[model samples]
Target: MVIIIFHFFLIYSAAAVGLAPPSTYLDGCQPMSCKRGAPSVRFPFQLKGRQNESCGSPGFNLSCNNKNQTVLELPKSVKLLVKRIDYVKQMIQVYAEDGCVQRQLPNLTLSSSPFEFMSDYYSFDSTYKNFSLFKCAGEGWSHYGSYYTIGCLSREPGSYVKYTSSDYPNTDLFHCSRTMDLREVPEGLISDESNNLYFNWSRPECGDCEARHQGCRRNDTKPSGFECFVIPIKHMGTRTKLMISGISIGSFFLALSLSVVLYMHHLHKKEKDAQGKIEQFLEDYKALKPSRYSYADIKRITFDFKEKLGQGGYGTVFKGTLSNDVSVAVKLLNNFKGNGEEFINEVSSMGRIHHVNVTRLVGFCADGYHRALVYEYLPNESLEKFIFGDKGENHFLGWEKLHEIALGIAKGIEYLHQGCEQRILHFDIKPHNILLDQHFNPKISDFGLAKLCSKEQSAVSMTAARGTMGYIAPEVLSRNFGNVSYKSDVYSFGMMLLEMVGGRKNIDVKVEHMSQVYFPEWVYNRLDKGEALGMSIENEEHDKIAKKLTIVGLWCIQWYPVDRPSMKSVVQMLEGEVEHLTVPPNPFASKEEMRAKLPINRELPTISE
Candidate 1:
């Protein structure tokens, strides 16, 4: 009767605390398991507590086998061997036999649930300890892996122990920019056999339990959990509450302190890198600033080039005012150069040449690789703005503008070749490259790819080609196509002229549609049949100019560089009134009637959209 009354009293005490009956618990924790000797297994987790149905949350559930090895049923076809568990920190160490078979992957979902990952965006952790190692005789040397450390409450500098491979994409399964990262390794665990060694994992800080509580003692025999001390009834006083508050404050500050240290370390590295970049930028363009302007003036003139006009692949251009509000385009490079080659090149070319259709160079900024070239700012934008592609808006330049612009471009190219001491090849010539001034007169821009060669040299052997596709000379594709020469610029300019005439791109070609309409080939086909393109642009004078431009375009893109006329002759033709344009034979057509059409493999990279 006394025993029964004691049990009922214990039940009442538990009820007052909102504690459910032990029978309702998922942990069927035997009295022996509940003993202080047994390692701790907390709520939402247990040591195989279910009789037949089994323990814990549906997703986090796992069971211990007969010999005390934790067994996790990740899936019907998948199982991971749980190596160890840290109850105070809440983590489980498991070894997967092989990577999930992709199709039969385990579902470790926590979304809309209490458990969730730290990051919404999938990325490797910078704080987590990462390593790549090779097994002596293992399948592959230097096997790659990563692990993250987390801290619920702080204790010491090395107290946190990280968890990894807990969820999909968190481990090896991941994607980047709409593309999957496919791991390439044969089925089975990575093994190094020569030294007869296993993949050694870094030991976690979880060997000891959490710090500070009611008189806790370290349990060496159990080794993974704790032993609680009985709190004296008298000590649970006003002073006890204050003491507890102080400990909580200390713990909170400890975690905050660790974060502060990490952040400070990152800031230090950032400052160092910034200094290095500035120094390098100054060194690379060393010759430029001293020869042109003082450091004090550079700061004043640029507002430091801070008033940016635009940015391009070569560099960023800023608007600057100097000496009585004279507008200038200050070009600052995005990347640092090895030496002053690029600076010297820009200054040398712009300094020597003077033409009505060229943007004049005024000053330079070669202070380190922070190179910037100053030029006169044109009120009008690039030709790419006026015509090219399916232009929907109607600020129509019409035939008059196109004719004047084409003639101006021809003269610009002519000057680049003949006006300079040596022939200068404008490797890149496109609609976007054609700049306009206040008068809307076209002037060739972007001489970064310009190269100087003696006129006597019939063919210049180029190391590698640099130019835009659709405008890139055929010789760049293969030597058999043509010889790389100043005429290559003429070919690119010709394509630009045709695009202007049609008010859209003449090349309707694609990587997959290489066999379709090549601009030169398609134009030749149309002209040979004596048919107009039936485009939207119309006027008799415009039609006449379009026909002449097309014929000139065909002449410029001739198979052999030797066959193409000089830019001087091209200017005369574009500026001429009489119509005596000669038609050329088709070169881009089939070399033979029976041979298969071929796609050439060459070095090419896509520009960012």
Candidate 2:
């Protein structure tokens, strides 16, 4: 009778808390297996934009890149590719997306994110590395072979830095740029080849609970936040002890009551906000030319979302046939976040675009937040499904085809940046976003993250970081790299091009041994040393295509936004001879401290609509 009463109380508590039965509500945290070599994701770590936020603790949200790699975005806009997550040890192993650890050190503060240095009740695998960064004028320390040489600081002309082990300078500092000491990092973590780093965080130890097949969560009634509720039958002993210590049934009931009210309120506010945002967007995009379709029309066109095409950060795609016998892809966006900026962006930007390389926006539907976009259906899917997929019989696109695809993507980007009346910067340009037609021609798609600005404007403003982890330019992640501009898109394109050349992700931890996980840096090292491009060369033409793509990609991904060439230059470089094309400076070699000044233009209106 007592057991039955206890079970009834639990059910009542769960209902009062507005939670599904434990089997359902807690199922979100079930270990998730990634397609690639990424580690299984579980408690305290959830894939952002995919898994529910409640599945993970605050500051533990992660994102999966198009390449199926898991990434963690830290404060100060640093993104580290997750190599491993040791649940028992509560440690996470990560490698810098770019091999430059020094560049990420300045922003590696723990205050903004939940992650903390080893000093904060956690232990690290290695000791900290202390290095000195010296800024000198005109490469005075050029003769020093031992020093890590960073090129001229962009802000201060004729100033260069010799990154070294000691704070004491061996030579005179007469012609030096401003020098600073980097944060003490794990020893050997900032070396020329250093790419992997580790961080640990304190979370409730739930291994025993998990072993016993029970769910664990924080004991919110506790003040220190260290206590947990090991759920189901396994934690009965702990519950008995807590009950004896005056953890009243009433307090738990009260918490459940409050949580229910708060959750309902949150849901109400979220729906209200989403509706208002959509309404405001409709008002702003009233001038948009894409004909708006009703929700019934969307259902008719999409045939009730039956034939699925693909999925992405924003939504899912389905195949549809129009009244005119034209095949179309209808994208139905998820409405839970972002204030409808992505929906407005697609309709406003792609509706006005007309180019063979750019995806044609056929129409849209925004009836009561049933947001969907219709586009001309290409027979072939995205370039990612072709190039980055497992090398099966159908996955291979030969070098000539790959080269043609690369050139087509370049032209599409150039058209967007230069040909548009108001230059549209497609912030997210990865293989997944690039669609291919039956003839294997490439078309730029997914303008949801696109930003618009006048042709004369040098840069656009942003409230938060946008774009995928591996492809985001240094500047877009943090202002310290340089001003965000069209060059940011170039950086993304460069990464994609490199992926095409390597026939793999640029940062594949499984293949690249040692600190050579960052493929761009590895390529730079080989190219600088005049090593054979390190690819399986079928013939002279294949070698030339690989070399050309590698060189152009290197040039496009220069660390500073200013150092990267415009899309127009990238196109020319791609078309030029492989021998004529010079390998760009190692993007990860050294940091460009100073940036060139550009004439500031009037601030453009916010792209809220």
Candidate 3:
């Protein structure tokens, strides 16, 4: 069946290559600019009024303002004036129209756009340094020459705003009070002069063409892709054209035949190796007593895979029913690229856990190449739907229910880390993995990235970092923070707790104000100032519950793993009164120190589960 599909794909490719002729419009798409000295926009960057859509890549559209200045609008409505574009280097120099890019730094996010900060692209580091913003009384602080004053945020009443990159600034010396921390701007890009930000694009890659002084255009064979072509000369001889055509046709067939043979051989070898590993794993764990079903049984239970509960990188989950009339969620492992390691991990960790807060593994199917795991169905679904859906959904849960849910999740994580004989570390602990029952009780699910170690073991060995981004602990990404231990799970839980309090994602780029972009940091600053948490607080009791959760979350997310509390301590803190809870030290304080530890050009191993 696989070979037949491959043959069809090969035939389709051949037809596509034959049908797609070279585009004749390249000569018409000449470079244009808003005015003299303005950056010339060409291929991959189209001038909106002057060029057609086919002339440039998607999301690379540029426009000219009334002042005849080249303008580029990034995601979230950030507009910058284009100063210069280096096509060979694939970099763009842009600055805010107001001449102060620092004013827009908080809301400036490039993740959704095709461009990336030049410093980030070169350094291979996504971490940002925290710049402490201070509002000082009186404007005659020229003695503190190291600090730069933000003219836009400064006031006329003998007060001005100054910022320093130092994590611990001497506030008394400058006679200033810390207002907030700016983390979006990189240390290398921040300057007192004109805020010229350099950004480079990796897509519509034409560096090779630019180096050779050739033309690049969209690949006609694949519209979503790109291709480089040689510059055409006027009036080619017929003999030269015939010779070139013959050579290209001959080479195309030769390469296609070779690729087909090699691909088939590679697929056969991979399937044999994967099957062998599965068989060995099953033999090793056969003594464990979960009912193993055949492929036919899985089909019948899922009613021919009709209803899909969810789909992820690993596989698709279907809603199913057992012979005993019990409902179950069957996850069919369709994209099994690993050597049965994730299958082994899930079964090994979940088969032994029986806590009320943990999801139950009822049965599994390992028939031939088909593999699936059946879990008890939770009618209320995941906690993510309720918390992040809408204002109405959040109101339904209320502050009290959110507090209770937080405690239940903490207890569940505690059980995974300690209740069982072997310490089970759930590498992924986001809100999506936490399922809620009809009674709204939380159950931890998804053990594909779980690790098992003896309770006596202080840390576990890891070949690669696991878990979803934004929730992964510092140590898991780099060992400079600490060892990969149960504390990693604690860090992830802390992030989720903060997310629950804000009723939004922890790293929200769509926030209206720059200061609120990083929700956790913003929450910490608000709490530190002894101000109202800006959340939906109807009364003082709800306020107390929110503060307690926030404090516990802050404590759990401390920069160093040693500073974070254990799951056991986390549960106690959650259960304790808000008055007894104390706010943790700023987690963003040591970002500069930790950023130095990240090695450049270090390739993280691919996690294939």
Stretches of model 3 off by over 4 angstroms after superposition: 1-289, 390-396, 591-609
Instruction: Give the number of the best model, judged by lDDT.
Output: 3
Cα displacement (angstroms), candidate 1, residue 586, comes to 2.1
Q: Give the whole-model CA lDDT for all candidates, comma-separated.
A: 0.58, 0.75, 0.81
Please provide, for model 2 over 353-460, each residue's C-alpha lDDT reduced to its tens digit, 9 standing for 90 to 100. 888999989899999968999998999888887767574545778888999899999999999999989999999999988999999899999999998888887788
lDDT of residue 313 for candidate 2: 69
Better of 1 and 3 by TM-score: 3
Going through the candidates in order, what is the number of backbone clashes in each? 18, 8, 0
Off by over 4 Å in 1: 1-291, 294-296, 337-341, 389-391, 509-517, 592-609
Better of 1 and 3 by lDDT: 3
Q: Model 2, poorest ten-residue lDDT window?
A: 595-604
lDDT score for residue 326 of model 3? 90
Per residue, candidate 3 scores C-alpha lDDT tens digits across 160-268 of 8888876664555447788877665566555535476778888888888889987777665866487777766445468756655665566556556766777788899
Global Cα lDDT for candidate 1: 0.58
| Native-to-model Cα distance after best TM-score fit, residue 347 in candidate 2, in Å | 0.6
Query: Per-candidate TM vs. native?
Result: 0.47, 0.50, 0.50
Q: After superposition, how far is residue 9 of candidate 2 from its true place, in Å?
A: 99
